[model samples]
Target chain A: MKHLDFWFEFASTYSYPAAMRIEKLAAERGVKVRWHAFLLGPIFKAQGWRDSPFNLFPAKGNYMWHDMQRVCQRYNLPFVKPSRFPLNGLQAARIACWYQDAKWLSAFVKAVFQANFVKDLNIADPAVLEQILNDLQLDAEAILTQAQSVESKARLQAANQQAVRLGIFGAPFFIAGQEPFWGQDQLELALDWCLHSEANLSSFG
Target chain B: MKHLDFWFEFASTYSYPAAMRIEKLAAERGVKVRWHAFLLGPIFKAQGWRDSPFNLFPAKGNYMWHDMQRVCQRYNLPFVKPSRFPLNGLQAARIACWYQDAKWLSAFVKAVFQANFVKDLNIADPAVLEQILNDLQLDAEAILTQAQSVESKARLQAANQQAVRLGIFGAPFFIAGQEPFWGQDQLELALDWCLHSEANLSSFG
Candidate 1:
């Protein structure tokens, strides 16, 4: 099976749908998914945007909210417009980076998404994160402390750097080999490519 | 039958794919498609972009080219990288405006897309457009002359203003009732919404 790297930012509105369903979808296709937590702030800044384009342009911003609502409805996903746009995901991303290889990584990611998008909670709030960690029976203090360590922080920085080097400008981007697919809408296509590309590999070898 | 208004700019790359297949797809679903030709230059300017974002952002431009290649291959549409990014579509839009409800409107739209994307021809060239019209058995000189009329030009301007009024900031936008769906990927969803929403109307009545 081919592997896919799912580059996502916790604050990305589109990534919520992808995060909530990626594991099951990838498993169904017998493809492996590597969850990558990265920040989109740097990418936007590089593009000369001081803020999310949604915030900079009022019309586009309004359309995005309604568009997201339609998308959520289509997917039957619970959605509540976050009270704050682009919730700070630094802590969540660090934790996700630290737990990259853990079995509970997907659970933590989905929980964080639900917290921000469904519960409309401030994901940057340590107490909210602690509750999520505690609910999962993880040691909140220990993990949070470890996640903030210089080493873990460096790892996330490297991940964001990797995303940029890969030419990713948005969240919920997928990379299978050299093929990069952006947006939650391309999830199915990405997974299918992973499967088909791998199947063609042995023939080439 | 439910009606869908496809708001497209001739210079928009993604609209090439949608324009090619929309007529057939709409006919199959017993839906009517209203083609709206408009200029995106004015809209982009309103959004404070002096040029297409594809040109303003190199990384995104590179990614879009590859992504478009993948999409075209998937759809089995012939693909070519246009020598000029966003070839001027002013003349095409004017002509499309003049023929908005003509029986050959869809044919002309698809031909123009094919000329720009498949043949990598400049859609702004009157000679190129004249050839396309001649091939379609239309009076090339007469129609081209009419398309440049002040009234036709104003009609195209009005069409573009309407797009902005409806909060469209991108090409390949579709509207059903008050709902707006942007991007070629959203075409299916827009069509489905058109169908389902119409079906629900009689029940409510």
Candidate 2:
């Protein structure tokens, strides 16, 4: 069976769309997904981009907001532009890092995506994340404390390093057998490639 | 009676995909398209980008190539990567400036796109453009001469100035009244907005 590794950031608006759709789409294609949550803030700072490129250019930012609305409409998803343009995704990523189980990872991703895009909550706020945990019936304080553990922090750092090594400079990146696909719109194609690439391998063999 | 203006650059790869699809889609939705050919090279230079941002960043360029392959496959369009990207579009834009009729503009754009992406021909070559003109049953020499006229150059320049004023930084941009939509992928949304905006205006009034 084919598998896709979905690398996403909680603060990423585009990632919200992909997260909302990837699982259902993958199931239809008979492909399994591995959700990998990572922080893009550190990566952006490393690249000297002070903010999301979309925000840096006002026209691009304006267009992106409208574009997201249309895309959300097409997907039949609610889209409320987040109050904070680039929320601190570090805590969410840390939680994701601590919870590596597939089910927990997906739930966390959905919760975070919904919190940012649908609820218009500041994902960086610990209170918002605590509420997310409380709603999920998980131990809010325990998870928040776990997210602050040195091991979890190191794991996030490792994820950021891995993203850089893989040449990712943006959010919503996917890796399938070393091939990287960037952007939410590229999700379907990435899955298709992962599913279809075996034929090329067989031919080469 | 709703019409949307499509601003495109001859050298943009994604624009070819949108250009090939827009007319049919617009017809389906009972909307009209007004094609506006403009140069992005001057615009990028004005923004201090030497080449397409995709090319400037290797990772982005790589992902974009993969993404284009997928988009083309989905559309079932022949998409051989062009050897000369960011092809000198000055002559093409000048010629388009001279020809406002939809028939000539559509055929010329199709020919240019085919030349670059399908045949891998150097679009900057006069001989290649002459061949395209001849194939269209157009007088190659006369068109070429006219495309080079001082008035034609000024017209192209004026179009670029208009793009600057309109806050265009990329190709395949659409304008529906005061709203702007960027990228080939957003063509449908732009068309939809054009069709529905009148209802919005009436409701507001």
Candidate 3:
């Protein structure tokens, strides 16, 4: 079976559309999508950014908001600019990293993006994450406890290290074999690379 | 005829593909393209960037080169990493701006991009611009003289100011009606918007 690794940061606005649709798109291409939730905060800080580049560069941010509106409208994905730019996703990311193999993981990822980008809710709030987990029929309290544990926190740190090693500067990022594709718009191009490049299919190997 | 404004910096990598293909694409869609040659230097400076973001960020620079290869391959356009990245496009831009309404403008724009991104030539060289102009059967010396005049310089400066006012932070940006689409990837989307959008087709109005 062909496989591709998808790296997404929860607070990323473009990741909203990419997460909402990637599974079906990948499945259609006979590709198994590996969901890896990661943090952009560390990567961004390393780049000397004190805030989201969008906030720091007002013009890019202005164009992005307008562009995202069009992107969501085109895809029928509901979008509302979050009340706060780049709400913290540390808690959400820990859960995702810890439960990476859980059957409901993808749903949880999508729901969290929706909560932030669609519902304009602060995803950093425990109650918000708990509500999202409960809505997915998962044990909210238990998962929250585990996600907040030192162990889960370490796993997330490791994931960020791995992402940095992979040279991912943004999300949604994808790795098809040894190739890296960035941006939500590159999602199909990445998958197509996975399907067509018979020479390189051992994603993240 | 329906119309769209194309904003391109001669040194922009993605603009290579966008410049090579936009005319045919727009013509096919019954849309007229208004090519606006502009500088990204002022825009970047305003954003506090001392260099191209691609250069300022190493990881992104690495990803961009790889992605450019794939993009070029997918489009069947020639690709070559210039000996110098982001070669000064100032001289070429001045010519492009001064001659924006000339019949041979589009051909000249494509030639300049081909020179910089494909043939690995310094587009900033007057000899290179002269050669491209000579190839177009235009009087190279006369055009070069006019392009270097104070009036031409002011036009280029004005063009950059206009792009800034329009919220254009990157190239190749497109304006279909009042909509601003950034990057070469958005060219088609911009054209489609021009064809479909009825309420705001006055363009720069």
Candidate 4:
């Protein structure tokens, strides 16, 4: 079976839409999606940005807010502009790393995205993450505790390193075989590559 | 008829695609396209960039080249990487400004894009601009000379000022009423807005 890797940053607004819909879309194309939760903070810092570009450039921020509203409306997805520019996703990402290969990873991702984009909830708070885990019937305290482990922290770091190595500059990025597709809008294009490209199927190798 | 403003930078890679295809696409939608030839240099300078972001970030530049190849292949259009990074489009833009109200503006725009991206020619050369004009059955020397006049220079400047006032930060930016859509990818989205948006159709007013 062919697979596409989805690299996402929880703080990324566009990733919210990709997260909400990628699985169903990929499944329709007979492709499996490998969800990889990563951080954009380190990447931005490397680019000498102290904050999200949306905040760094006011006009861009205004345009993005308006664009996001339009996009969400088109997709019929619930969207409320978060009061905060970029919600800290460190805790959520760590927890995602801890449950990286778990069956409920996608559900956890959707819930976290909903918390940040739909509910406008601060995802950085431990209590918020714990509540989400409880809602999923997972052991909240145990998972939260493990997510804070030294090894768990290192795993998240490794993921970021992998993303940087792959030349990923933004979130909601995809790798189908050797081809990298950036942006939520390219989700379908990536899926098409996964379903069709025969020569580069060994790219993941 | 509803209208969409297509703000393009002659040196913009993405604008090449939008310029080549917008007229036919807009015609199909019964939407009128207002081609606005503008310079992105002032906007980039305002953002404190001395070069294209593609040059500022190597990884992004690499990805963009690959992306452009894929896009061209998908569209079945001729693609040749230009010899120069961002060809001096100042002359081409000024020429475009002089022909701004001409019926052949779209054809000239497409021809210029093909020359730069397809043939990898130096669009800044007066000889090249003259050749393109002559091919279109226009008086090459006369138009080229007129394009260099003081009034024509001011016309280009005023167009750039209008783009800045419209919050256009990049090439191939589109404005359908008040909704600004940035990037070549948003061309269809902008057209769709032009066809369906009634309330915001008076945005330009």
Cα RMSD (Å) per model?
Answer: 3.0, 3.6, 2.2, 2.1
Error of 4 at A33 (Å): 1.2
DockQ of 2: 0.30
- Chain B TM-scores, listed for every candidate in order, come to 0.95, 0.94, 0.96, 0.95
The TM-score of candidate 3 is: 0.96
| lDDT score, candidate 2, position A103 | 59
TM-score of 1: 0.95
Model 1 per-residue lDDT tens digits across residues B1-205? 6799999999999999989878878888888999999988988898789998899988888888887887787788998989998899999899999899999888899999999999989899999999999999999999999998999998998888788888888889888777788889888878877878745332100
lDDT of 3 by residue, A25-106 (tens): 9999999999999999888899899888889888789888887887898799989988898899999999999999999999
Most accurate candidate by DockQ: 3
| CA deviation > 4 Å runs, candidate 2 | A28-30, A42-48, A175-181, A188-205, B27-30, B165-167, B176-180, B188-205
Q: Clash pairs of candidate 1? A: none
Model 2 lDDT tens row, A2-78: 89989998888889899999999999999889888887777766645778877776656766787688679779999
Report, for candidate 3, the interface RMSD.
4.3
Task: Please report how far candidate 1 places residue A114 from its true position, in Å.
Answer: 0.6
lDDT by residue for model 3 over B90-155, one digit each (tens)? 988999999999999999999999999899999989999999999999999999999889999999
Residue-wise lDDT of candidate 4 within A91-139, one digit each (tens)?
Answer: 8999897788899999999999999999999999999999999999999
Off by over 4 Å in 4: A199-205, B199-205
Off by over 4 Å in 1: A199-205, B199-205
Model 4 over residues B1-205: C-alpha lDDT tens digits?
Answer: 8899898888899999988878889999999998889998888888777899888877788888888887787777888989897888888898788787899888888899999999999999888888898899988888888888999899999999988788778888999888899888889989998977875443231
lDDT of each: 0.88, 0.81, 0.90, 0.88
